[model samples]
Target: MFLLVLLQVLQPAGAQFCPDLCVCSGGAAELRSVQCGGAGMSALPVNVPPDTVKLRLERTLISRVPRAAFYNLSELRFLWLSYNSVTSVHPSSFVNLKALRELRLDGNLLTSFPWEGLRDMPRLQTLGLNNNRLSSLPAHAALFLPNITYLDLSSNRLTILPAELLDLWFPLPELQKGPVRRKILGLHDNPWLCDCQLSMLTSLSSSLGSPVVLMDQLLMCSRSMAPSGMLLTRAELSRCTRPSVQPAATRVVSPLGSNVILRCDASGYPTPTLTWIRTSAYTDCCQQNLLQNSEQPPRILESFMQGSPRVGVRWSIITLNGLSYQDAGEYRCQARNMAGTSEAPIKLKVMGVTRLSRFPKRKPKKTPFKSSPKFRKPNQTLPEKESPFIFPPLKNKIQKV
Candidate 1:
């Protein structure tokens, strides 16, 4: 077998010395390329060949590349910077690479990118963003990706494809007015939540829209586990739904003056806001005083934003303190969002206790006369009805000294 080699010519100026710990080679005459992978350099090397066509810098320590890093390389085409510590990128980093075609940015920590920066490159075709930590796409991501024929977003933390993306990519004239192109989209290995809105991707047809070739076998549900592991194409998203209050278990019988924590977990699109409301009409835990007319109806005992992605996950916690006889009633946790409102009831039963002590007891004193009420001793145990001691319950989680 005969091997073909591209001729390499070295110009006399600064082209003779290659960048430290990097291998640079290509034709200096018409087509040039630079191979600088695994250099262990922390910054973009200075003085790259001006006529470099292809540049590879995989597995390097380069953390970031500012706007003017590759400003001079007008003939640059293919660029690879995968497996690096690149956390950010300036909008104008590729402003001068007009002849660029393919761009690779896999295995990085880019949560978001500048979308308007793509207006500079009119000839862009392919883009790879796999193996990254992207949770959500920008709303206007479609405007910047109109000309893309191939896109890869696999192995990321994406749950739902935004409605904006679905309407813009398909060829339907009513949804979006643009020249529709048959594109190959890679979205495997993502924590894709099969929301009902995602049905648009799998339901595209050639008559009214361009044929979308979604890899359904590889598109398994991530958050809500299934037994058969159905594909996205066959999974009826409308049928594939669950209530906001999953499992729907909330009821506690905490003792009087005892602190109790009521859990309210919700799951829905656009994340739900959790709030606790006392069902009784008379009072609530947040009521400052019984005599105040403008008490504002207790202002919801507690409220918190459930920490989770806007998909099938969990909600927040609510701690009710110093349970009293009045607090023994129905408490409902309401979760409301743009989708709708759902509530879970917590029936609390608070039992009264006159006294309870964990302190060391004292010995009884000798009663000389039996006429008196039997000379009560400190060591004597008080029955449920006879004890006169009543202590305030704890306010917070920690015990007060």
Candidate 2:
């Protein structure tokens, strides 16, 4: 009985039996580390202690990670699953790893990752995804990993990246102030396309004191307009010109109380910003005044803009709802970039009255008693009153009597 009591005192509180072919080490109060590798394991160990802070599973035969695989390990901080045959991971696999700081999944057969699951790991800073077969990444991946400092994406099959990701990676010079933290980004050993978009990467990499640190490997383009397998640093990208706009319709005719959609497309080397502006109103009195004031800025209309990064093209669209006579105007589609600016004009014409104003006019009714001879007056005519339905004739139109 005394020996049994001593054995009980040596065990940890709420401790469970460790898995076979694995090793666990810590004091009697808690388990701090677990290492499982090359033990012919086909799946993750289920009996890992809840208090484990570090877990390493290397050279295993695990194929995929299921949801809630580590739900019981809340204190886990450092996880290394290198050199496994992992092909995919569930979106919710890391939902419970709130305290996870560094995650390494290098040397796998993954073609894609569950980027949405990264939101659960707010403290994650170092991510190792090199030596995989990823061809593309989501445009908003940077939004999920806001605190990422070290990102390894070398030896992949990436060709083009979205403009949204580049904008976040290198913000405007005015917005970058104060002491910038050192960030390491590994983007070598990929087949990058040589285009106006790729030129941005070369220019940004040459900056003297940039906070970002790209690996020392030289970048080369696999496909380009000039020649294949050309060095990115020596490519002639200055031949790319400013944006040009192509309007769908130069003149549009619509009736009042109707809807109309205007569309225009722009193409350039460095993508350009598309804007819709109202250059002149339809009012006759304001038409001359608007044309005389050349310095007056045109009114900008709310529009939706979308881009295709692969082809370096963008489209702008605007919908006019409940068209009124006041909506008739000349609209200009403007595309601007570092190279230069271009514009295309579209004239809109509105006709016919609105449905709400098309009701028949009613005349005042005459009562028999009021019009009787007994109430008649001699040679005194009732004051003439004009009807409210009378409207002025349109400018430059003849009125029939």
Candidate 3:
């Protein structure tokens, strides 16, 4: 057999150009690449290989990722820029990385999701964006990341999950194949409003032995029987979605100087929860102060929409501070244990004015001091009145002070 040698192009400059973007140690022979994560780079660093397989820029100061940031990096497989101060992931940011497999972008400042930016990575397998400030997932957010198997979405501020999340097939259909099922799901640590709208998540929990596990346990309930709190375990959550066993009505009552009480009167396999929250500015009062557990309340929150269909997450008030307007806002009553949280929202409106009345002055009865009864002189001889003794003119005038 003839001996064969494999020749690889060597670049001496790769060792010298390791700036704050990455730190390369040893010589080029042992160094595969450089990673400059959290380097505070304003833009992509200089001297990075176009074909580098792994690039980590997490927690960096890079605000604007240019379109050509990774131009011609056909061999690039892994790119991590999570926890950076990045506000936006520009459109076409990752268009050239067709071979990318894993991308980590959790813990960044993304107001709206970048749906289009991720479509170009056809081979991307794992994506992480767990801890961000996303109130709601965009409709069909999973379409862009179809190939993702492992997703991390813990520790975010998500009030209402998209209805599409119920249609799990649409988001990730590819994971259904192969002998080893693609383990694809991550939804803990989100402030999931435990309501009828989220009944689907409760239902799904039953089909799977557990709430599909993907991320860590950092979920907080945005609306529940209580103020902000964490959600319960998966098994209990499944029982919460079962159909009612009794037909009931929600009753709300206000108590004297204590927290309000929200009650639910729905019949289901397990009793549901009652929770509340402040209305969002985008919605009118009719939509605001809504029942967190019910899609709609049996009555309009303010009776403005009286004819509207009745849903059943009831509210009762236990007013604190004599019930003043300042105490008015939104409150959530959440009921959750091993089962996931179920909640309802009640808006407290101090009906009529809430002012204290001055105490009434008590009338004084005319209590006549009755004259002592005049009785005839006792049978015994009345003491004889002594003859009036006449005193003389008197002593000398008292001396003046």
Candidate 4:
């Protein structure tokens, strides 16, 4: 017993301190890293050495990440949680990893982004969320990734872009035309609906200066309409505008003090501006008054996205409230743009009874939208005009056309 006690007292203190599942090699409290990769672990290993900087759990059977999973590892800088079956992450799972630089969550079963999970990672540089089942991202989610330099959102299902997405993500100063501006914004392998609304995103793509790219080659759109499988780089407004009224002119009937809506659809680059004008020989109570001062004016202009190709059937709708005798007239829905303008008229017949006209409505606007060259290797060279985009013409990470 005396000899045993003496031997223990002389032994190294690190032996009993190391985690049972992990293989510790360094001296006491000085372990550099831990690798539980392919260890078939279902959860994070706790009681890690205090000085440990790298922790790898790749190819593990871990299914979920519990709250404050890494709270004790304040010094952890590199975390590898990829190639696992992780599906859910508690909002506080990564809150304590303030020093984490790179987080790999790819090849998981995640259906949605846990934006709240990254609340405290100020030094996080790269975020790999690729090859997941994410269908959408919170509109304000990009606001939380200012320090992130590389982001991967490839392979998922998304049809529309969030409103004011570019404005909220990259500030105006960072978007100024120049060399070396934007970072790697991967948006490949998703079904994008390229329509007038998509013009907003394409316009943003143009403003994103040199040295930065959003995976131009992978920028493609698909739909059952005229254009399908078209590259976004060739989807310029000027190249895709054909203005015309959606439906043939008709007559609208409504009662006094009732509500009514007149709609017109047009197609073009920059989405043609809509103007509602009261026209017709209205010598009756309805006069030129509509051309002058009027309170409770039109509130909004509604537009629709049909998921067709470029500018596939844009709409302009106007609402009229508290209708009176003075409101009865021939109203014109004019669609205008730099290319030109087209007007479609509707006659209003007010009566006490609600009725539908036996007349038929017009057919859809006929126009085909699609284009761009075949795919090529990144190392291959190509012509100037055949190239998709040439903006920030001077230079970028990928050479400017």
User: Candidate 4: deviation at residue 104, Å?
Assistant: 1.3
Ranking by lDDT: 2, 1, 4, 3
lDDT of 1 by residue, 1-401 (tens): 01111111334553454566677775656566677766468888666667788888888888887985677677888888898888888888888878889888898888766677777677788888888888887768888887878788888888877655665566446545555677767787877776554554655532254545544336767655332456766665534222377424556776768997767778765566677787653234433343244334544676543466556556676666887666666678777653345677777776555456589889655433222234344454445453233222222213544
Best by lDDT: 2
Q: In angstroms, what RMSD does candidate 3 have relative to the true structure?
A: 20.7
**Estimated TM-score per prediction?**
0.53, 0.61, 0.50, 0.52
- Determine which window of 10 residues in candidate 2 has minimal summed lDDT: 388-397
Decide which is better by lDDT, 3 or 4: 4
Across 231-329, the per-residue lDDT of candidate 3 in tens digits comes to 544323433442221112233334334454333333232444332343422223332343234333332232111111233222233324454333444
* Model 2 segments more than 4 A misplaced: 1-16, 27-31, 173-181, 238-401
The candidate maximizing TM-score is 2
Whole-model lDDT values for every prediction:
0.66, 0.75, 0.52, 0.64
Question: What's every prediction's RMSD, in angstroms?
Answer: 20.0, 12.6, 20.7, 31.7
| lDDT tens digits, residue span 55-173, model 4 | 77777778899887887678888887888999888878886788999888888888887786676788988888888888876777866876677778777666655543444444456
The alpha-carbon lDDT assigned to residue 108 of candidate 2 equals 87
State how far residue 397 of model 4 sits from its true place (Å). 99
Per-residue lDDT value at 149 in model 1: 80
Residue 317, candidate 1: alpha-carbon lDDT: 66
